[model samples]
Target: MTKSQPYTQADLAKLGNVLIYLVDRLGPISKTKALKLIYLVQEVSVKTYGLPFFNMPFLVWRLGPVAEDVFVDLSAEEPVLLANYIQRQEEDCKTFIHASQPFSDDEFSDNEMEILALVAKTYGSLSAERLVEVIHRPHSLWYQTARENGVLDYLEQGRMTTTNFEIDFGRLLDDMPERKRMYTGQLDYLEQSRALKV
Candidate 1:
């Protein structure tokens, strides 16, 4: 609504909790790995400590290649921040976004918003194994969550399920002049027209 109020601290906590919930829901995460992760996060942030916006992209941006160095305790060969790094650019609250680009103030579509909400809910909570469970089919048949081959079922569903939200979920796309229609609309201000302007 208003840029004056940033996301509340409580919102962050809820988001974090939701992430944890999603992970657990998708889990059979071993207690050992979970505990190890908790401890490792606590430990590793030590050197990279006190950085205000502790997003992975920011760390990687500032540290460059050094950030590629692993967090040995976690057993990760490459240390990585575990979220979909979205940016908020104030002089103080600078963060990251998709494709390493600055996010603008444009409104998101309902489905896109839902996708974000799901992600915020699912973020830090889900382990790699759990996330792979929800997002991708497990490589082994034993791991299938669906009664049938869930991955194959999902692939067939995806074929026609409007996978690209930018176009699919966007109301503006619906507002666009339909194909094979007459040129009743102007293209001057459309994003695709920008390059053509020159």
Candidate 2:
């Protein structure tokens, strides 16, 4: 989609639940780590299921893939969307996120829940800086998008800038030819269906 899109109330609730789930499983986490974990969950879900866990658009930021709205909400002094589900606390000069409410799986499918657990188990223990390094690896979607958008060059030149490049989720299928074919076919069907709706 575009670099940003408005999330419906249902969408915000689902995102909030997911965040609470992560916080409950991983213990209190940094905003950076929580954001990266969300990205990882999306990445794994796309690669394995041929769809994203959430409809949220990820931007190729300097650290990694970031959902701008979630980032802003988490950083806000009073979070509007996730205020009921998560709370931010400052300790040792760093902000940590905690679950303010019990997580509900109502918004997730069985497969989605599995993927969430898998991502938490796989990357939960890593520090935010470590997660950043992981996402920066060659061939990672964030790395590829950032490189294409000149964010990498900007960093190499030691220039300070705010770059928000949309990460192309379709590229996740590049290495899987069969999956790519299937994914494209589904996309074609979707386009046709939308056209019919018009």
Candidate 3:
């Protein structure tokens, strides 16, 4: 059966999301599987990559001629904040961007804390608003996804302000019933910190 040639926005989003998750858990990334994911998506040559697009799309697949995988440089060029990612998304109308800088510190709370930690080592520090932007992906499906994903219930003034992140953390620690397995996982992260020298 013949397969598709072009990659859809969702496919692109999927790759972007997966890469984002990988960056959160790991740090920095290699260009090795960049081509593999695209080829599997396009089914172009049973090894298709992707068309070169501007905005650096976080991914690239040089199908016909170059025959290579290309990834965008999500470098911090400058300190990135919530405004940075949000403004860029508003300008580009897409979430294909990646982080080019990283900073690790326990400067956040709630999902913001870990989310911040995850991106810290890759995207640097993000403002609560910027963190909200990442949490607001279309696939995230607000309201439902917010709670399911342990993102909502963390908002303050109906917005995910930094204060809300701390509030969420405090509330989670105080009210165990509302906590999810992810909450337990975060606790483990904190526990690990206690094991440290500093």
Count of clashes, each model: 7, 0, 8
Cα lDDT, all candidates: 0.27, 0.80, 0.30
Name the runs in model 2 displaced over 4 angstroms: 1-4, 156-158, 181-198
Each prediction's TM-score versus the true structure: 0.21, 0.86, 0.21
Best by lDDT: 2
TM-score of 1: 0.21
Looking at model 2, report the run of 10 residues with the lowest lDDT sum: 1-10
Each prediction's RMSD to truth: 17.7, 3.4, 19.5
- lDDT for each residue of candidate 3 in 1-198, tens digit (9 for 90 to 100): 012133334333333444454444444333323222222222221111121111111111111111121322222233222222211121233233343324332232244333323333533343323433543444322333345546555542344522111112222133344443444454455445434522
lDDT of 2 by residue, 86-107 (tens): 9998889888899888998888
Angstrom error at residue 31, model 3: 1.4
Compute the lDDT of residue 91 as modeled in candidate 3: 25
Model 1 residue-pair collision total: 7
lDDT of 2: 0.80
